[model samples]
Target: MDFSSKLLENAVYEMSQLPGIGKRTALRLVLHLLKQPEERTNLLSEALTDLRAKVNFCKSCHNISDTEICEICSNHKRDKSLVCVVEDIRDVMAIESTSQYNGLYHVLGGKISPMEGIGPQDLSIVSLVNRVKEGEVKELIFALSSTMEGDTTNFYIYKQLEGLDVTTSTIARGIAVGDELEYADEVTLGRSILNRIPFENSIKAS
Candidate 1:
Protein backbone atom coordinates (compact mmCIF):
# COMPACT_ATOMS: atom_id res chain seq x y z
CA MET A 1 0.00 0.00 0.00
CA ASP A 2 3.06 2.28 0.00
CA PHE A 3 2.83 5.15 -2.49
CA SER A 4 5.71 7.13 -3.93
CA SER A 5 3.63 10.31 -4.20
CA LYS A 6 0.80 11.95 -2.26
CA LEU A 7 -1.24 12.39 -5.46
CA LEU A 8 -1.00 8.68 -6.23
CA GLU A 9 -1.87 7.88 -2.63
CA ASN A 10 -5.00 10.04 -2.78
CA ALA A 11 -6.01 8.51 -6.12
CA VAL A 12 -5.55 5.00 -4.74
CA TYR A 13 -7.59 5.90 -1.65
CA GLU A 14 -10.48 7.21 -3.76
CA MET A 15 -10.48 4.25 -6.13
CA SER A 16 -10.18 1.78 -3.26
CA GLN A 17 -13.31 3.28 -1.72
CA LEU A 18 -15.34 1.59 -4.44
CA PRO A 19 -16.98 -1.66 -3.27
CA GLY A 20 -14.94 -4.88 -3.70
CA ILE A 21 -11.82 -2.94 -4.82
CA GLY A 22 -8.69 -2.98 -2.65
CA LYS A 23 -5.63 -0.71 -2.40
CA ARG A 24 -3.47 -2.87 -4.66
CA THR A 25 -6.13 -3.01 -7.38
CA ALA A 26 -6.74 0.70 -7.06
CA LEU A 27 -3.00 1.37 -7.48
CA ARG A 28 -2.95 -0.83 -10.57
CA LEU A 29 -5.90 1.12 -11.95
CA VAL A 30 -4.18 4.45 -11.20
CA LEU A 31 -1.02 3.21 -12.93
CA HIS A 32 -3.11 2.08 -15.90
CA LEU A 33 -4.73 5.51 -16.08
CA LEU A 34 -1.33 7.15 -15.77
CA LYS A 35 -0.06 5.10 -18.71
CA GLN A 36 -3.08 6.06 -20.84
CA PRO A 37 -3.29 9.36 -22.71
CA GLU A 38 -4.60 12.40 -20.81
CA GLU A 39 -7.57 12.49 -23.17
CA ARG A 40 -8.64 9.03 -22.01
CA THR A 41 -8.68 10.11 -18.39
CA ASN A 42 -10.49 13.35 -19.27
CA LEU A 43 -13.06 11.38 -21.25
CA LEU A 44 -13.68 9.06 -18.30
CA SER A 45 -14.05 12.01 -15.92
CA GLU A 46 -16.36 13.86 -18.29
CA ALA A 47 -18.55 10.78 -18.82
CA LEU A 48 -18.95 10.23 -15.08
CA THR A 49 -19.73 13.93 -14.55
CA ASP A 50 -22.31 13.96 -17.35
CA LEU A 51 -23.95 10.76 -16.02
CA ARG A 52 -24.28 12.23 -12.55
CA ALA A 53 -25.64 15.55 -13.82
CA LYS A 54 -28.05 14.25 -16.45
CA VAL A 55 -29.54 11.01 -15.13
CA ASN A 56 -32.96 11.09 -13.46
CA PHE A 57 -35.38 8.52 -11.99
CA CYS A 58 -38.62 7.82 -13.74
CA LYS A 59 -41.60 9.56 -12.15
CA SER A 60 -43.84 6.52 -12.44
CA CYS A 61 -41.61 3.50 -11.72
CA HIS A 62 -38.61 5.26 -10.19
CA ASN A 63 -36.23 3.47 -12.60
CA ILE A 64 -33.26 5.29 -14.17
CA SER A 65 -34.45 7.45 -17.01
CA ASP A 66 -33.56 10.44 -19.15
CA THR A 67 -37.15 11.70 -19.11
CA GLU A 68 -39.89 11.96 -16.46
CA ILE A 69 -41.07 8.39 -17.12
CA CYS A 70 -39.11 5.30 -18.14
CA GLU A 71 -39.62 3.69 -21.53
CA ILE A 72 -41.14 0.55 -19.93
CA CYS A 73 -43.76 2.53 -18.05
CA SER A 74 -44.62 4.55 -21.15
CA ASN A 75 -44.82 1.56 -23.47
CA HIS A 76 -48.39 0.80 -24.56
CA LYS A 77 -47.55 -2.84 -25.37
CA ARG A 78 -46.70 -3.59 -21.73
CA ASP A 79 -49.58 -4.76 -19.55
CA LYS A 80 -50.24 -1.84 -17.21
CA SER A 81 -52.49 -3.90 -14.95
CA LEU A 82 -49.73 -6.38 -14.09
CA VAL A 83 -46.95 -4.89 -12.00
CA CYS A 84 -43.66 -6.54 -10.99
CA VAL A 85 -42.37 -5.02 -7.76
CA VAL A 86 -38.56 -5.19 -7.51
CA GLU A 87 -35.70 -4.02 -5.30
CA ASP A 88 -34.00 -1.76 -7.85
CA ILE A 89 -33.32 -0.99 -11.50
CA ARG A 90 -30.92 -3.96 -11.71
CA ASP A 91 -33.79 -6.29 -10.92
CA VAL A 92 -35.87 -4.47 -13.54
CA MET A 93 -33.15 -5.06 -16.12
CA ALA A 94 -32.85 -8.74 -15.15
CA ILE A 95 -36.57 -9.33 -15.48
CA GLU A 96 -36.77 -7.46 -18.75
CA SER A 97 -33.93 -9.52 -20.25
CA THR A 98 -36.14 -12.59 -19.91
CA SER A 99 -38.53 -11.20 -22.55
CA GLN A 100 -41.19 -13.42 -20.98
CA TYR A 101 -42.73 -10.71 -18.83
CA ASN A 102 -44.99 -8.31 -20.69
CA GLY A 103 -46.02 -6.29 -17.63
CA LEU A 104 -44.99 -3.00 -16.10
CA TYR A 105 -42.61 -2.55 -13.15
CA HIS A 106 -42.41 -0.79 -9.77
CA VAL A 107 -38.81 -0.34 -8.60
CA LEU A 108 -38.67 -0.11 -4.78
CA GLY A 109 -35.14 1.39 -4.94
CA GLY A 110 -34.15 -0.86 -2.01
CA LYS A 111 -35.46 -3.35 0.55
CA ILE A 112 -36.17 -3.19 4.29
CA SER A 113 -32.98 -4.08 6.16
CA PRO A 114 -32.85 -3.28 9.86
CA MET A 115 -29.13 -4.06 10.19
CA GLU A 116 -28.35 -1.65 7.34
CA GLY A 117 -30.85 0.91 8.73
CA ILE A 118 -33.06 0.63 5.67
CA GLY A 119 -36.79 0.82 6.39
CA PRO A 120 -40.00 0.80 4.40
CA GLN A 121 -40.04 4.59 4.40
CA ASP A 122 -36.58 4.67 2.85
CA LEU A 123 -37.81 2.97 -0.32
CA SER A 124 -40.47 3.80 -2.95
CA ILE A 125 -43.22 1.75 -1.20
CA VAL A 126 -45.65 4.64 -1.08
CA SER A 127 -45.50 5.14 -4.83
CA LEU A 128 -46.12 1.41 -5.37
CA VAL A 129 -49.15 1.43 -3.08
CA ASN A 130 -50.48 4.50 -4.82
CA ARG A 131 -50.03 2.80 -8.19
CA VAL A 132 -52.15 -0.12 -6.99
CA LYS A 133 -54.74 2.12 -5.30
CA GLU A 134 -55.20 4.30 -8.36
CA GLY A 135 -56.99 1.24 -9.73
CA GLU A 136 -55.87 -0.07 -13.10
CA VAL A 137 -53.43 -2.54 -11.52
CA LYS A 138 -54.98 -6.02 -11.12
CA GLU A 139 -51.92 -8.00 -10.07
CA LEU A 140 -48.87 -7.23 -7.91
CA ILE A 141 -45.87 -9.53 -8.46
CA PHE A 142 -43.18 -9.43 -5.81
CA ALA A 143 -39.90 -9.89 -7.68
CA LEU A 144 -37.47 -9.02 -4.93
CA SER A 145 -34.46 -11.10 -3.84
CA SER A 146 -34.98 -14.11 -1.53
CA THR A 147 -33.01 -12.67 1.36
CA MET A 148 -34.53 -11.77 4.73
CA GLU A 149 -34.70 -8.08 3.88
CA GLY A 150 -36.38 -8.82 0.58
CA ASP A 151 -39.01 -10.97 2.33
CA THR A 152 -39.68 -8.31 4.94
CA THR A 153 -40.13 -5.66 2.28
CA ASN A 154 -42.45 -7.89 0.27
CA PHE A 155 -44.56 -8.65 3.35
CA TYR A 156 -44.82 -4.97 4.15
CA ILE A 157 -46.02 -4.12 0.65
CA TYR A 158 -48.39 -7.10 0.63
CA LYS A 159 -49.98 -5.79 3.83
CA GLN A 160 -50.23 -2.29 2.39
CA LEU A 161 -52.34 -3.59 -0.50
CA GLU A 162 -54.53 -5.73 1.80
CA GLY A 163 -57.92 -4.02 1.52
CA LEU A 164 -57.42 -3.32 -2.18
CA ASP A 165 -58.95 -5.60 -4.86
CA VAL A 166 -55.60 -6.57 -6.38
CA THR A 167 -54.23 -10.12 -6.62
CA THR A 168 -50.73 -10.43 -5.17
CA SER A 169 -48.00 -13.03 -5.84
CA THR A 170 -44.27 -13.64 -5.49
CA ILE A 171 -41.89 -15.15 -7.99
CA ALA A 172 -41.49 -18.87 -7.26
CA ARG A 173 -38.53 -20.02 -5.20
CA GLY A 174 -36.74 -21.62 -8.11
CA ILE A 175 -33.63 -19.62 -7.29
CA ALA A 176 -31.92 -20.53 -4.01
CA VAL A 177 -33.32 -18.97 -0.82
CA GLY A 178 -30.67 -16.24 -0.52
CA ASP A 179 -29.94 -15.59 -4.18
CA GLU A 180 -30.58 -12.26 -5.86
CA LEU A 181 -32.69 -11.97 -8.98
CA GLU A 182 -29.93 -10.11 -10.78
CA TYR A 183 -27.60 -13.06 -10.32
CA ALA A 184 -30.01 -15.74 -11.44
CA ASP A 185 -29.86 -17.12 -14.96
CA GLU A 186 -32.57 -15.94 -17.34
CA VAL A 187 -34.23 -19.35 -17.68
CA THR A 188 -34.70 -19.85 -13.94
CA LEU A 189 -35.77 -16.25 -13.32
CA GLY A 190 -38.20 -16.39 -16.24
CA ARG A 191 -39.74 -19.66 -15.08
CA SER A 192 -40.08 -18.31 -11.56
CA ILE A 193 -41.94 -15.30 -12.89
CA LEU A 194 -44.26 -17.44 -14.99
CA ASN A 195 -44.98 -19.75 -12.05
CA ARG A 196 -45.27 -17.13 -9.34
CA ILE A 197 -47.27 -18.18 -6.31
CA PRO A 198 -49.88 -16.25 -4.37
CA PHE A 199 -48.50 -13.79 -1.87
CA GLU A 200 -50.63 -15.34 0.81
CA ASN A 201 -49.18 -18.77 0.07
CA SER A 202 -45.66 -17.40 0.14
CA ILE A 203 -46.26 -15.73 3.47
CA LYS A 204 -47.93 -18.79 4.95
CA ALA A 205 -45.04 -21.04 3.94
CA SER A 206 -42.52 -18.67 5.49
Candidate 2:
Protein backbone atom coordinates (compact mmCIF):
# COMPACT_ATOMS: atom_id res chain seq x y z
CA MET A 1 0.00 0.00 0.00
CA ASP A 2 1.20 3.52 -0.86
CA PHE A 3 0.71 6.39 1.54
CA SER A 4 0.94 10.15 0.97
CA SER A 5 2.03 10.71 4.55
CA LYS A 6 4.74 8.78 6.42
CA LEU A 7 2.95 9.49 9.75
CA LEU A 8 -0.20 7.74 8.55
CA GLU A 9 1.88 4.90 7.13
CA ASN A 10 3.72 4.46 10.44
CA ALA A 11 0.45 4.44 12.40
CA VAL A 12 -1.10 1.83 10.11
CA TYR A 13 2.03 -0.29 10.22
CA GLU A 14 2.01 -0.31 14.03
CA MET A 15 -1.71 -1.08 14.16
CA SER A 16 -1.32 -3.92 11.66
CA GLN A 17 1.21 -5.53 13.98
CA LEU A 18 -1.65 -6.43 16.35
CA PRO A 19 -3.07 -9.93 16.04
CA GLY A 20 -5.91 -10.44 13.53
CA ILE A 21 -5.41 -6.95 12.09
CA GLY A 22 -4.44 -6.66 8.44
CA LYS A 23 -2.91 -3.71 6.64
CA ARG A 24 -6.29 -2.66 5.18
CA THR A 25 -7.99 -2.79 8.58
CA ALA A 26 -5.07 -0.97 10.14
CA LEU A 27 -5.28 1.73 7.46
CA ARG A 28 -8.98 2.20 8.11
CA LEU A 29 -8.34 2.46 11.86
CA VAL A 30 -5.57 4.99 11.35
CA LEU A 31 -7.82 7.05 9.09
CA HIS A 32 -10.59 6.94 11.66
CA LEU A 33 -8.21 8.06 14.38
CA LEU A 34 -7.01 10.84 12.15
CA LYS A 35 -10.58 12.02 11.69
CA GLN A 36 -11.14 12.16 15.42
CA PRO A 37 -10.33 15.24 17.49
CA GLU A 38 -6.66 15.76 18.34
CA GLU A 39 -7.49 15.35 22.03
CA ARG A 40 -9.18 12.00 21.40
CA THR A 41 -6.15 10.73 19.46
CA ASN A 42 -3.88 12.00 22.19
CA LEU A 43 -5.98 10.14 24.75
CA LEU A 44 -5.64 6.93 22.76
CA SER A 45 -1.90 7.36 22.50
CA GLU A 46 -1.63 8.17 26.20
CA ALA A 47 -3.67 5.14 27.22
CA LEU A 48 -1.51 2.78 25.19
CA THR A 49 1.61 4.38 26.54
CA ASP A 50 0.36 4.09 30.12
CA LEU A 51 -0.67 0.51 29.60
CA ARG A 52 2.77 -0.47 28.41
CA ALA A 53 4.61 1.64 30.99
CA LYS A 54 2.53 1.20 34.14
CA VAL A 55 0.80 -2.17 33.93
CA ASN A 56 1.94 -4.79 36.40
CA PHE A 57 1.47 -8.55 36.65
CA CYS A 58 -0.14 -9.94 39.74
CA LYS A 59 2.58 -11.38 41.95
CA SER A 60 0.40 -14.36 42.85
CA CYS A 61 -1.36 -15.32 39.59
CA HIS A 62 0.57 -13.28 36.99
CA ASN A 63 -2.57 -11.67 35.60
CA ILE A 64 -2.13 -8.12 34.26
CA SER A 65 -2.81 -5.60 36.99
CA ASP A 66 -2.24 -2.03 38.08
CA THR A 67 -0.95 -3.09 41.49
CA GLU A 68 1.37 -5.78 42.75
CA ILE A 69 -1.58 -8.14 43.22
CA CYS A 70 -4.72 -8.38 41.13
CA GLU A 71 -8.14 -7.70 42.64
CA ILE A 72 -9.17 -11.35 42.29
CA CYS A 73 -6.10 -12.63 44.12
CA SER A 74 -6.54 -10.02 46.85
CA ASN A 75 -10.24 -10.62 47.27
CA HIS A 76 -10.83 -12.30 50.62
CA LYS A 77 -14.07 -13.98 49.48
CA ARG A 78 -12.41 -15.93 46.69
CA ASP A 79 -11.52 -19.59 47.37
CA LYS A 80 -7.77 -19.47 47.68
CA SER A 81 -7.53 -23.24 47.97
CA LEU A 82 -9.11 -23.74 44.53
CA VAL A 83 -6.74 -22.34 41.92
CA CYS A 84 -7.79 -22.41 38.26
CA VAL A 85 -4.89 -22.83 35.83
CA VAL A 86 -5.18 -20.92 32.55
CA GLU A 87 -3.03 -19.84 29.60
CA ASP A 88 -3.20 -16.08 30.13
CA ILE A 89 -5.27 -13.07 31.18
CA ARG A 90 -7.74 -13.50 28.32
CA ASP A 91 -8.70 -16.96 29.57
CA VAL A 92 -8.94 -15.57 33.05
CA MET A 93 -11.38 -12.91 31.80
CA ALA A 94 -13.37 -15.57 29.94
CA ILE A 95 -13.73 -17.75 33.03
CA GLU A 96 -14.49 -14.80 35.26
CA SER A 97 -17.39 -13.81 33.00
CA THR A 98 -19.06 -17.17 33.77
CA SER A 99 -19.42 -16.19 37.45
CA GLN A 100 -19.62 -19.92 38.26
CA TYR A 101 -16.27 -20.11 39.98
CA ASN A 102 -15.22 -18.33 43.16
CA GLY A 103 -11.71 -19.73 43.06
CA LEU A 104 -8.42 -17.96 42.45
CA TYR A 105 -6.37 -18.38 39.24
CA HIS A 106 -2.82 -19.09 38.07
CA VAL A 107 -1.87 -17.86 34.60
CA LEU A 108 0.66 -20.18 32.92
CA GLY A 109 1.55 -17.49 30.32
CA GLY A 110 1.25 -20.10 27.53
CA LYS A 111 0.96 -23.81 26.78
CA ILE A 112 3.71 -26.26 25.83
CA SER A 113 3.83 -26.17 22.04
CA PRO A 114 6.96 -27.71 20.52
CA MET A 115 6.08 -26.24 17.13
CA GLU A 116 6.05 -22.78 18.72
CA GLY A 117 9.15 -23.49 20.85
CA ILE A 118 7.11 -22.90 24.01
CA GLY A 119 8.09 -25.47 26.62
CA PRO A 120 7.29 -26.11 30.27
CA GLN A 121 10.09 -23.85 31.42
CA ASP A 122 8.69 -20.99 29.34
CA LEU A 123 5.59 -20.91 31.60
CA SER A 124 4.93 -20.28 35.28
CA ILE A 125 4.79 -23.99 36.18
CA VAL A 126 7.50 -23.75 38.81
CA SER A 127 5.74 -21.00 40.72
CA LEU A 128 2.55 -23.05 40.57
CA VAL A 129 4.34 -26.07 41.95
CA ASN A 130 5.71 -23.91 44.72
CA ARG A 131 2.20 -22.65 45.49
CA VAL A 132 0.99 -26.25 45.74
CA LYS A 133 3.95 -27.22 47.91
CA GLU A 134 3.25 -24.34 50.25
CA GLY A 135 0.05 -26.25 51.13
CA GLU A 136 -2.32 -23.30 50.54
CA VAL A 137 -3.79 -24.58 47.31
CA LYS A 138 -5.88 -27.69 47.95
CA GLU A 139 -7.05 -28.29 44.39
CA LEU A 140 -5.82 -27.31 40.90
CA ILE A 141 -8.31 -26.84 38.07
CA PHE A 142 -6.63 -27.15 34.66
CA ALA A 143 -8.50 -24.63 32.55
CA LEU A 144 -6.22 -24.48 29.53
CA SER A 145 -7.70 -24.86 26.04
CA SER A 146 -8.61 -28.35 24.76
CA THR A 147 -5.51 -28.70 22.56
CA MET A 148 -2.60 -31.10 22.51
CA GLU A 149 -0.29 -28.45 23.89
CA GLY A 150 -2.78 -27.63 26.63
CA ASP A 151 -3.07 -31.28 27.57
CA THR A 152 0.69 -31.69 27.56
CA THR A 153 1.12 -28.68 29.84
CA ASN A 154 -1.56 -29.99 32.18
CA PHE A 155 0.05 -33.45 32.33
CA TYR A 156 3.46 -31.92 32.96
CA ILE A 157 2.09 -29.90 35.86
CA TYR A 158 0.21 -32.92 37.16
CA LYS A 159 3.43 -34.90 37.23
CA GLN A 160 5.17 -32.08 39.04
CA LEU A 161 2.54 -32.24 41.75
CA GLU A 162 2.84 -36.03 42.05
CA GLY A 163 2.53 -37.39 45.60
CA LEU A 164 1.41 -33.96 46.77
CA ASP A 165 -1.76 -33.58 48.81
CA VAL A 166 -3.43 -31.28 46.29
CA THR A 167 -6.13 -32.78 44.06
CA THR A 168 -5.99 -32.18 40.30
CA SER A 169 -8.85 -31.85 37.80
CA THR A 170 -9.52 -30.75 34.20
CA ILE A 171 -12.51 -28.98 32.67
CA ALA A 172 -15.02 -31.35 31.09
CA ARG A 173 -15.11 -32.11 27.36
CA GLY A 174 -18.11 -29.83 26.97
CA ILE A 175 -15.48 -27.67 25.32
CA ALA A 176 -14.73 -29.28 21.95
CA VAL A 177 -11.26 -30.60 21.30
CA GLY A 178 -8.80 -27.94 20.04
CA ASP A 179 -11.15 -25.15 21.19
CA GLU A 180 -9.86 -22.28 23.22
CA LEU A 181 -11.55 -21.41 26.51
CA GLU A 182 -11.71 -17.74 25.49
CA TYR A 183 -13.94 -18.58 22.54
CA ALA A 184 -16.40 -20.85 24.37
CA ASP A 185 -19.79 -19.50 25.37
CA GLU A 186 -20.19 -18.49 29.00
CA VAL A 187 -22.79 -21.19 29.69
CA THR A 188 -20.65 -23.99 28.25
CA LEU A 189 -17.54 -22.80 30.03
CA GLY A 190 -19.45 -22.52 33.29
CA ARG A 191 -20.83 -26.04 32.93
CA SER A 192 -17.37 -27.39 32.09
CA ILE A 193 -15.92 -25.76 35.19
CA LEU A 194 -18.74 -27.11 37.32
CA ASN A 195 -18.33 -30.61 35.88
CA ARG A 196 -14.56 -30.88 35.87
CA ILE A 197 -13.16 -34.40 36.27
CA PRO A 198 -10.05 -35.87 37.79
CA PHE A 199 -6.84 -35.30 35.85
CA GLU A 200 -6.07 -39.01 36.11
CA ASN A 201 -9.44 -39.82 34.48
CA SER A 202 -8.70 -37.42 31.63
CA ILE A 203 -5.30 -39.03 31.14
CA LYS A 204 -6.89 -42.48 31.02
CA ALA A 205 -9.54 -41.37 28.53
CA SER A 206 -6.89 -39.85 26.28
Candidate 3:
Protein backbone atom coordinates (compact mmCIF):
# COMPACT_ATOMS: atom_id res chain seq x y z
CA MET A 1 0.00 0.00 0.00
CA ASP A 2 1.16 3.60 -0.69
CA PHE A 3 1.83 5.84 2.28
CA SER A 4 2.20 9.62 2.44
CA SER A 5 5.24 9.24 4.75
CA LYS A 6 8.10 6.76 4.85
CA LEU A 7 7.81 6.85 8.66
CA LEU A 8 4.24 5.56 8.48
CA GLU A 9 5.29 2.82 6.07
CA ASN A 10 8.09 1.80 8.44
CA ALA A 11 5.72 1.68 11.42
CA VAL A 12 3.25 -0.48 9.47
CA TYR A 13 6.03 -2.80 8.37
CA GLU A 14 7.33 -3.31 11.89
CA MET A 15 3.86 -3.89 13.37
CA SER A 16 2.95 -6.32 10.59
CA GLN A 17 5.96 -8.42 11.49
CA LEU A 18 4.17 -9.58 14.67
CA PRO A 19 2.59 -13.04 14.49
CA GLY A 20 -1.02 -13.18 13.15
CA ILE A 21 -0.87 -9.47 12.23
CA GLY A 22 -1.35 -8.64 8.53
CA LYS A 23 -0.34 -5.53 6.58
CA ARG A 24 -3.90 -4.16 6.54
CA THR A 25 -4.30 -4.60 10.30
CA ALA A 26 -0.88 -3.04 10.90
CA LEU A 27 -1.81 -0.03 8.71
CA ARG A 28 -5.10 0.34 10.61
CA LEU A 29 -3.19 0.37 13.92
CA VAL A 30 -0.70 2.93 12.57
CA LEU A 31 -3.49 5.18 11.31
CA HIS A 32 -5.35 4.84 14.60
CA LEU A 33 -2.21 5.84 16.53
CA LEU A 34 -1.75 8.82 14.23
CA LYS A 35 -5.26 9.96 15.01
CA GLN A 36 -4.48 9.85 18.73
CA PRO A 37 -2.50 12.45 20.71
CA GLU A 38 1.28 12.25 20.42
CA GLU A 39 1.57 11.40 24.16
CA ARG A 40 -0.47 8.23 23.64
CA THR A 41 1.98 6.99 21.00
CA ASN A 42 4.93 7.98 23.18
CA LEU A 43 3.52 5.95 26.10
CA LEU A 44 2.98 2.92 23.85
CA SER A 45 6.52 3.18 22.48
CA GLU A 46 7.99 3.73 25.94
CA ALA A 47 6.22 0.68 27.37
CA LEU A 48 7.50 -1.51 24.52
CA THR A 49 11.00 -0.10 24.95
CA ASP A 50 11.00 -0.75 28.70
CA LEU A 51 9.68 -4.28 28.21
CA ARG A 52 12.36 -5.15 25.65
CA ALA A 53 15.08 -3.55 27.75
CA LYS A 54 14.19 -5.12 31.11
CA VAL A 55 12.23 -8.36 30.60
CA ASN A 56 13.94 -11.35 32.13
CA PHE A 57 13.53 -15.15 31.76
CA CYS A 58 12.93 -17.18 34.87
CA LYS A 59 16.22 -18.85 35.79
CA SER A 60 14.54 -22.07 36.92
CA CYS A 61 11.70 -22.59 34.40
CA HIS A 62 12.75 -20.27 31.52
CA ASN A 63 9.37 -18.56 31.49
CA ILE A 64 9.24 -14.79 30.86
CA SER A 65 9.60 -12.86 34.07
CA ASP A 66 10.76 -9.56 35.53
CA THR A 67 12.92 -11.36 38.12
CA GLU A 68 15.47 -14.14 38.00
CA ILE A 69 12.91 -16.63 39.41
CA CYS A 70 9.27 -16.38 38.48
CA GLU A 71 6.49 -16.23 41.09
CA ILE A 72 5.42 -19.83 40.37
CA CYS A 73 8.86 -21.29 41.02
CA SER A 74 9.26 -19.23 44.19
CA ASN A 75 5.95 -20.29 45.71
CA HIS A 76 6.42 -22.57 48.73
CA LYS A 77 2.92 -24.05 48.60
CA ARG A 78 3.32 -25.47 45.09
CA ASP A 79 4.28 -29.15 45.01
CA LYS A 80 7.89 -29.15 43.88
CA SER A 81 7.93 -32.93 43.52
CA LEU A 82 5.18 -32.90 40.89
CA VAL A 83 6.35 -30.78 37.96
CA CYS A 84 4.30 -30.07 34.84
CA VAL A 85 6.35 -29.66 31.67
CA VAL A 86 4.94 -27.28 29.08
CA GLU A 87 6.00 -25.71 25.79
CA ASP A 88 5.91 -22.02 26.73
CA ILE A 89 4.64 -19.36 29.13
CA ARG A 90 1.40 -19.19 27.14
CA ASP A 91 0.70 -22.81 28.12
CA VAL A 92 1.47 -21.97 31.72
CA MET A 93 -1.10 -19.17 31.60
CA ALA A 94 -3.66 -21.48 29.99
CA ILE A 95 -3.14 -24.17 32.65
CA GLU A 96 -3.11 -21.70 35.51
CA SER A 97 -6.46 -20.35 34.34
CA THR A 98 -7.98 -23.76 35.17
CA SER A 99 -6.60 -23.58 38.77
CA GLN A 100 -6.58 -27.40 38.75
CA TYR A 101 -2.83 -27.92 39.04
CA ASN A 102 -0.95 -27.08 42.22
CA GLY A 103 2.40 -28.38 41.03
CA LEU A 104 5.43 -26.47 39.74
CA TYR A 105 6.25 -26.08 36.02
CA HIS A 106 9.23 -26.65 33.73
CA VAL A 107 8.85 -24.64 30.53
CA LEU A 108 10.69 -26.20 27.57
CA GLY A 109 10.83 -22.76 25.85
CA GLY A 110 9.77 -24.47 22.59
CA LYS A 111 9.00 -27.86 21.10
CA ILE A 112 11.37 -29.95 19.00
CA SER A 113 10.58 -28.95 15.40
CA PRO A 114 12.95 -30.53 12.85
CA MET A 115 11.44 -28.53 9.99
CA GLU A 116 12.07 -25.29 11.90
CA GLY A 117 15.60 -26.34 12.96
CA ILE A 118 14.59 -26.33 16.64
CA GLY A 119 15.78 -29.38 18.58
CA PRO A 120 16.25 -30.62 22.15
CA GLN A 121 19.53 -28.70 22.35
CA ASP A 122 17.75 -25.44 21.47
CA LEU A 123 15.50 -25.70 24.56
CA SER A 124 16.05 -25.80 28.34
CA ILE A 125 15.97 -29.61 28.56
CA VAL A 126 19.28 -30.00 30.44
CA SER A 127 18.16 -27.77 33.28
CA LEU A 128 15.01 -29.86 33.65
CA VAL A 129 17.07 -33.05 33.89
CA ASN A 130 19.20 -31.37 36.52
CA ARG A 131 16.09 -30.44 38.49
CA VAL A 132 14.92 -34.06 38.41
CA LYS A 133 18.37 -35.35 39.38
CA GLU A 134 18.24 -33.30 42.55
CA GLY A 135 16.03 -36.20 43.81
CA GLU A 136 13.07 -34.18 45.01
CA VAL A 137 10.99 -34.52 41.88
CA LYS A 138 8.86 -37.69 41.80
CA GLU A 139 6.53 -37.17 38.84
CA LEU A 140 6.50 -35.18 35.62
CA ILE A 141 3.28 -34.11 33.87
CA PHE A 142 3.75 -33.49 30.17
CA ALA A 143 1.39 -30.62 29.35
CA LEU A 144 2.67 -29.81 25.88
CA SER A 145 0.22 -29.53 23.00
CA SER A 146 -0.75 -32.67 21.05
CA THR A 147 1.08 -31.64 17.89
CA MET A 148 3.80 -33.69 16.18
CA GLU A 149 6.55 -31.39 17.43
CA GLY A 150 5.12 -31.42 20.94
CA ASP A 151 5.14 -35.24 20.96
CA THR A 152 8.71 -35.38 19.67
CA THR A 153 9.86 -33.00 22.39
CA ASN A 154 8.08 -34.97 25.14
CA PHE A 155 9.55 -38.29 23.95
CA TYR A 156 13.05 -36.79 23.82
CA ILE A 157 12.75 -35.52 27.38
CA TYR A 158 11.34 -38.85 28.53
CA LYS A 159 14.32 -40.67 27.10
CA GLN A 160 16.69 -38.28 28.86
CA LEU A 161 14.94 -38.98 32.18
CA GLU A 162 15.03 -42.78 31.84
CA GLY A 163 16.03 -44.69 35.03
CA LEU A 164 16.12 -41.31 36.78
CA ASP A 165 13.56 -42.24 39.53
CA VAL A 166 10.83 -39.92 38.20
CA THR A 167 7.41 -41.14 37.07
CA THR A 168 6.44 -39.45 33.77
CA SER A 169 2.95 -38.97 32.36
CA THR A 170 1.20 -37.05 29.57
CA ILE A 171 -1.84 -34.86 29.97
CA ALA A 172 -4.84 -36.80 28.66
CA ARG A 173 -6.17 -35.80 25.25
CA GLY A 174 -9.92 -36.16 24.66
CA ILE A 175 -13.13 -34.49 23.59
CA ALA A 176 -14.77 -31.91 25.83
CA VAL A 177 -17.93 -33.00 27.63
CA GLY A 178 -21.27 -31.75 26.24
CA ASP A 179 -19.75 -31.46 22.75
CA GLU A 180 -21.32 -33.56 20.00
CA LEU A 181 -19.23 -36.62 19.12
CA GLU A 182 -20.10 -36.15 15.42
CA TYR A 183 -18.26 -32.84 15.37
CA ALA A 184 -15.16 -34.22 17.10
CA ASP A 185 -12.14 -35.11 14.99
CA GLU A 186 -11.32 -38.79 14.56
CA VAL A 187 -8.15 -38.67 16.67
CA THR A 188 -9.82 -36.93 19.60
CA LEU A 189 -12.87 -39.17 19.49
CA GLY A 190 -10.69 -42.25 19.35
CA ARG A 191 -8.57 -41.01 22.26
CA SER A 192 -11.66 -40.26 24.35
CA ILE A 193 -12.78 -43.84 23.79
CA LEU A 194 -9.39 -45.31 24.59
CA ASN A 195 -9.05 -43.25 27.76
CA ARG A 196 -12.59 -43.69 28.97
CA ILE A 197 -13.14 -44.29 32.65
CA PRO A 198 -15.37 -46.98 34.17
CA PHE A 199 -19.02 -45.92 34.46
CA GLU A 200 -18.81 -45.96 38.28
CA ASN A 201 -15.68 -43.76 38.29
CA SER A 202 -17.25 -41.33 35.83
CA ILE A 203 -20.16 -40.76 38.17
CA LYS A 204 -17.98 -40.10 41.22
CA ALA A 205 -18.27 -36.36 40.78
CA SER A 206 -22.07 -36.56 40.95
Superposed by TM-score, candidate 2 places the C-alpha of residue 68 at a distance from the truth, in angstroms, of 0.9
Off by over 4 Å in 2: 175-206
| Model 3 misplaced regions, further than 4 Å | 200-206
Q: Candidate 2 lDDT, tens digit per residue, 48-165?
A: 9999999899999999998898999999999999999999999999999988899999999999999999988899999999989999999999999877888899999999999999
State the TM-score for model 1: 0.83
lDDT of 3 by residue, 1-206 (tens): 88899999999999999999999999999999999999999999999999999999999888888889999999999988999999888999999998989999999989999899997889999999999999999999999889999888989999999889999999878887689988999999998899987889769844
Measured against the true structure, the TM-scores of the candidates, in listed sequence, are 0.83, 0.83, 0.94
Q: Order the candidate numbers by TM-score, best to worst.
A: 3, 1, 2
lDDT of 1 by residue, 1-206 (tens): 56789998998999999999998899999899999999998999899899999999999999999989989999999999999999888899899897879999999888999999998899999989999889999999999887888889989998888899999988766777889989999977887888887899879866
In candidate 3 the C-alpha lDDT for residue 172 amounts to: 77
Full-model lDDT for every candidate: 0.90, 0.92, 0.92
Q: Candidate 2: TM-score?
A: 0.83
For model 3 the local lDDT of residue 20 reads 96
Model 2, CA-based lDDT:
0.92
